[model samples]
Target: MNMAVIGMIAGMALAFAGYFGGFGAFLLVAALGAVGFVVGRFLEGDLDIGDIFRARDDRRR
Candidate 1:
């Protein structure tokens, strides 16, 4: 499915979850979804482990 369709479906699911399961369940689902996205990106070679925690560098004189 296209991104828009997928997004609509996900939005509906989240709304149902929030309505039926309340705020905690909504946050749980969101967190799990974020984890899944990260893992999928890693598997797709679009993300690296260090990318999550790596700090930026800056030099000043």
Candidate 2:
């Protein structure tokens, strides 16, 4: 669905995890959510694996 609804659902999930499962569970949910998001993007071809691993130029002054 839309981003707003997705965001709301994710928020609710985190809230439930925090309330019923504690901080560790909250963190676990958050981390898994992030991984899922990335995987989804990758699967959708919206993200390139090389983009994530490409090194940045840190020598720019």
Give the number of the best model, judged by TM-score.
2
Stretches of candidate 1 exceeding 4 Å from the true structure: 58-61
Clashes of each: 0, 0
lDDT of 1 by residue, 15-57 (tens): 8889999999898888887798789899999998877776665
lDDT of 1 at 4: 96
Instruction: Compute the lDDT for candidate 2.
Output: 0.95
lDDT of each: 0.82, 0.95
Best by the lDDT measure: 2
